[model samples]
Target: MTDLKHLFFSLGLEQLDLSEKEKNIINAFIEQSTPRFNDICHQRQDKEPLALLLGYMTQQHHIASSRWIEQQTAYHQMQSVFQSSVGTEHASKFINQDVDEYILITLLWLLVQGANKIDYSYANEQAETLLAHIHEETKESNDSKEDEQLRQRLMQAFYQGKKTTQQSLFTKLKRMFRLTQQQ
Candidate 1:
């Protein structure tokens, strides 16, 4: 496993002081969210839904927009480093490196946006619920979580929903699935 502390520090997210359980949750989230994120990026459709979700997380006050931007830039730099290092090697080498960094960056960003505060309600309920919504909206899975999605949707789905109301990280997730529900 990646040393969680070093990963966070590299990404400038060490201040979050996440517990072991919290680190596990973030790790699980990254594993579950990766395919969904990649699917959205590959679909060649509008990425606004996920982009909005990312914007909300990366822009949170505690995250410090400037620092987040810098970290994000650093992530890209890491990606470039991985790509250059694996020019003639097996593609998996570069992919694994990039994915690790991606997960770390994403976990840090999510934490800064208050992911750790999510109620999760049941034993692992919150994390799974959150993952299901992303998969549903991104069309990565058929499994559903209607109640969770509805509560999140209505909470965030108001006037100027996209333009004015800044949503919590999880609520902003409702945006991704809700838009797909209409299609």
Candidate 2:
């Protein structure tokens, strides 16, 4: 029974600081969701049936919010892993905590969307994007004052609109996946 934290780190990945409680929660969620994801994948094959699968997930009304919250919790765990490792080395390099959080959140967003659609390719693309973002952000000395202000403003807007933020993010994601609202 490899724990979730070690599961991510076992492949030479940075370790996230996930508490025992969080491990239990995420592990349980993954365990519970695995069968359904497999079933959905089998049913859909590779067809781009946008609304049906998304609809299926949305229909799980009671647990929908739980899934998103769990996704967020897993993201925090991911951040903790990076923060515990490279965070100090890059702290003084102009990268702020909010930027780190944003990166992690975006990674999580891509991962969740891919998983929901049963598309590992999409997830891998997101991983590449995340790596690129990290490479760009960590070049601390190269960050101009303008970049810093933009980052700060972005973070501020994200935090200020906590409610619609998620909605807007989903909207953007829907577009990325070519999913229509009517669908």
Candidate 3:
């Protein structure tokens, strides 16, 4: 298994059984989200963007699997797991309002696709509810233009059944570390 997959498994997150195309889409989402996150947050932590997105997604999964009354506990437990696994600095940023909305909308879009391991039985209902929330919250805001464009592209790719090549997670992490050191 790749390092990312192993890390997720160790954290008791879902299996990383995504196809190359799905992995590419997720990578693209992270890449796209990073610049936007940095622009808004004013600080660039190498792993924070990925950690925030993945952590929130995992938290949502846990929440969906738990009873309503137990959701708060589940959310806190997931946060603790992410904090311990990815470092508190990276994981703590997952609670920002803007970041939460962005991740939620994007995650709901992915869940709606219904092609990945991220989908649970109630994922469709959850996705619809979250999407409606997003729409309601953003009704008077124009900041979602970029998000909409990204969503359009992702939807196009999904509908077209396009598959992209993927690199091993180990190599990507190694390269990321090398880049970080050189900076």
**Best-matching candidate per TM-score:** 2
Put the candidates in lDDT order, highest first.
Answer: 3, 2, 1
How well does each candidate superpose onto the true structure, as a TM-score? 0.25, 0.27, 0.26
* 46-138: candidate 3 lDDT, tens digit per residue: 554334444544554445333332344555677678889999888866552343434433453343233333334344455444444444543
RMSD of each: 18.4, 16.1, 18.2
lDDT of each: 0.41, 0.43, 0.44
**Candidate 1 ranges with C-alpha deviation above 4 Å:** 1-12, 45-183
lDDT of 1 by residue, 1-183 (tens): 333333233333434445575556556655555555555545745654434334443443223333433454565566567657765354324432332333334344443333223322431333344344334432334434654553343222221222222344456789878988999
The global Cα lDDT (0 to 1) of model 2 is 0.43
For residue 121, give model 1's deviation from the true position in Å.
24
Off by over 4 Å in 3: 5-131, 142-147, 156-183
Local accuracy of candidate 2 as per-residue lDDT tens digits, 1-183 = 333223223211222333465445445554564566556656987753333334443344224433443455455566567768778556344323343434434422332343344354544444444444544534324345654543443333223333233555787997977866556
| Of 1 and 2, the candidate ranking higher by lDDT | 2
